[model samples]
Target: MKKNIPIFRTGDTIEVQVWVSEGSKRRIQLFEGIVISKRNRNFNFSFCVRKISNGDAIERVFHINSYNIGNVVIKKRGDVRKSKLYYLRNRIGKSAKIKELLTKK
Candidate 1:
């Protein structure tokens, strides 16, 4: 992982800015979602993000140390009881919501 990226837990919401290349042009694209899980590898680290778009659930995996990733911003920390939120895949509507964790500044 790159330096100074905030330590995020499984249930936290994050926005990742990624670089996209089209022809000879490059632009930054944002991917915001709730973290589903984090994976540790010998030399690679990755995380899974889930979001609901147009009433459809979408999940994407991102490599933490990739050059394509420009920034990772934390939006919210959830008060969750599970280490892995795979159960959230089956939830819909109000049941899919995660309670936000209160923090002291």
Candidate 2:
């Protein structure tokens, strides 16, 4: 993982800014979603984010040390017991939601 990236875990809602380049144009694209899983392997550390868009579920995997990742902002901390929230894939609406964890400070 990179030094600038903050500590995050599965079930957390996070917004990631990714740099997109199209020919001579370049822009930052935001992908906001819940982290379903994470893989830690030294330099190959990565996490998967899942979101619902246009009634379709979309999942994206991002490498922590990738240069294309501009930034990651944790929107909400989830109170989940499991490390991998793969069960959320089959859920919808309220069923797919995760409970928020209250933090002091």
Candidate 3:
């Protein structure tokens, strides 16, 4: 049986809550980053996230239908030119940044 998974697209800023196991205890960790790339349109889909951590750029890929994921929250929508923001990897400081979409009041 195929389970219905939540739909997520590229160029979206998402907050992923993942379950982490430490020793005999388990906890949920929150990771807030921008979606740089997405692959596989089916249940075996996965997406990559990029975030600057401690003066270093860190990128992580998460499965869309993984049980370890607690929740996926969209923070802000962005306007991007390409499907993959791989160019951002070569940039730093202000050059590697993405503009936020402002809504009209």
Candidate achieving the largest lDDT: 2
Off by over 4 Å in 1: none
* Stretches > 4 Å off in candidate 2: none
The window of 10 residues in a row where model 3 has the poorest summed lDDT is 1-10
- Checking candidate 3 for backbone clashes, the offending pairs are none
Q: Write down the worst ten-residue block by lDDT for model 2.
A: 1-10
Estimate, for each residue in 20-92, the C-alpha lDDT of model 3 and write its tens digit: 9999999999999889999986557789999888988889998877878888888887777788888888998
Q: In candidate 1, which residue pairs get closer than 3 Å at backbone N, Cα or C atoms, i.e. clash?
A: none
> Worst 10-residue stretch by lDDT in candidate 1?
1-10
Q: What are the candidates' C-alpha RMSDs?
A: 1.4, 1.2, 2.5
- Candidate 3, 63: how far from true, in Å? 0.7
Residues 1-105 of candidate 2 have per-residue lDDT tens digits of 467787899989999999999999989999999999999997678999999999999999999889899999999999999999999999999999999999999
Judging by lDDT, tell me the better candidate of 1 and 2: 2
5-58, model 1: which lDDT tens digit per residue?
788889999999999999999999998999989887865789999999999999
What TM-score, over all chains together, does every model reach?
0.91, 0.94, 0.85
Positional deviation of residue 78's Cα in model 1 after best superposition, in angstroms = 0.7
Residue 11, model 1: lDDT of 96
